[model samples]
Target: MDHDLALIVGLVLIILSIPSIIAAFSDGHAPRVAAFTIIAGGALLVWAISSKPGGYTISDVPDTFVRVVARYLP
Candidate 1:
């Protein structure tokens, strides 16, 4: 449950950061902060998902976890 929540929140942050990053790029403001945020959030989400509880074993290479993580951002 905790892992799921962390993954969800981190992905949300990454998704939210994209528009701000694009806006910064178009407006000639350095997007360094937004880029950093995206990287950090992505890392956190990956870590959280990878650290899921011991009961379940992941069988599929591209499962719902990957879909949920990648869908909104890309």
Candidate 2:
């Protein structure tokens, strides 16, 4: 559960960073911040998924997401 939460957060961060990365590249500006964010998020996500004895599968994501949302939002 902890790993799932961290993975989800990292994924969301990586997803959110996409727009910033694209904007920086499109505007010919430095993408340092966005790039760093993407890298960090990716690392955390990888670490979280790998930390457990058995890594998660694609099918686990949706349930994890819903569980996290329910836990946090409710």
lDDT of 2 by residue, 2-65 (tens): 8878889889989999999899999999999998998988987899888967898989889989
lDDT of 1 by residue, 25-66 (tens): 899999998988898888877777678765233463236467
Q: What lDDT, from 0 to 1, does candidate 1 have?
A: 0.72
Candidate 2 residue-wise lDDT at 32: 94
Question: Once model 2 is optimally superposed onto the true structure by TM-score, how far is the C-alpha of residue 12 displaced, in angstroms?
Answer: 0.3
Q: Which of the numbered candidates is closest to the native, going by highest lDDT?
A: 2
Model 1 residue 22 distance off true place after TM-score fit, in angstroms: 1.1
After superposition, the stretches of candidate 1 with alpha carbons farther than 4 Å from their true spots are 53-74
- Best of the candidates, TM-score: 2
TM-score of each: 0.63, 0.90
